[model samples]
Target: MIRHLVLFKLNEGVAKDDQRALAGAEAFAELGSLIPELREWECGWNTTERDIAYDYAINSLVEDRESLQAYLTHPAHQAAAGQWREFATWVIADIEV
Candidate 1:
């Protein structure tokens, strides 16, 4: 299995409750059902005041690298992820489990 993790930091002045942020969250929240290759899908805003903490995060799983690729390229996934591009920057890590 592959554990796919993404951490996001919203651009300056953007609040988590902003409509765009909410929309992105809603979109990602549905990905578990929308992407068949995803073995798991979990994402949410950060709940901390620490300066080092990212503003948001995604924790997901896939069966293998091929399945991970399928999830990454899926149209629904693309569309959902696009929402964040406008307001945030992120980092990702993938590990074989």
Candidate 2:
């Protein structure tokens, strides 16, 4: 089993309280439901004044590296990618389990 975790920091131009942010979060959270290779997925906005570098965290479980790769390249994921590319400042990760 592998756990694929990703944390995202939104770009400065992206407004967290706006419609775009809400919709993007919704779309990203729903990717697990649409992608069969993803055994689990959970993500949400960060609500802390602690100067955290990232704004959200995505936790996913997959069978192995192959499944993890598939999840990474999945088309449903691509759709979400398009949005992330535009709004995200950067992504940090620690993939292990």
Candidate 3:
């Protein structure tokens, strides 16, 4: 299996309530049902206030590297990522389980 994780930090002055951010987040929230390759999907805003904490995170599971790649390349994922790219930057890790 593969664990795909992503941490997102909004650019300076960007807020979660911004319409664009909301739309991006909503798009991501719908991905679990939209993509067939994902075995699991969870995403949300951070609840803690630590300085090092990312603003948002996505944790998903896939059967393997190929499944993970399919999720990454899915058009809905691409469109949602593009929306977030307008206001945030992120880091990702894909770990084999």
Tens-digit lDDT track for model 1 on 17-37? 999999999999999998999
Note the Cα lDDT for every prediction shown.
0.94, 0.80, 0.94
Which tens-of-lDDT digit does each residue in 1-97 have in candidate 3?
9999999999999988988889989999999999999999999999988889999999999998889889989999999999999999999998988
Q: What is the lDDT of residue 93 in candidate 1?
A: 100
Error of 3 at 16 (Å): 1.3
**Candidate 2 residue lDDT tens string, 39-87:** 8888887777567557877888998888988988988888886787777
Candidate 1 ranges with C-alpha deviation above 4 Å: none
Tell me the alpha-carbon RMSD of every candidate. 0.6, 1.5, 0.6
Single out the weakest 10-residue window by summed lDDT for candidate 2. Answer: 87-96
Deviation in Å, model 2, residue 16 alpha carbon? 1.5
Alpha carbon deviation, residue 88, candidate 1 (Å): 0.2
Worst 10 residues of 3 by lDDT: 15-24
The CA lDDT at 75 in model 1 is 97
Steric collisions counted per model: 0, 0, 0
Candidate 2 regions with alpha-carbon error over 4 angstroms: none
lDDT of 1 at 97: 94
The clash tally of candidate 1 reads: 0
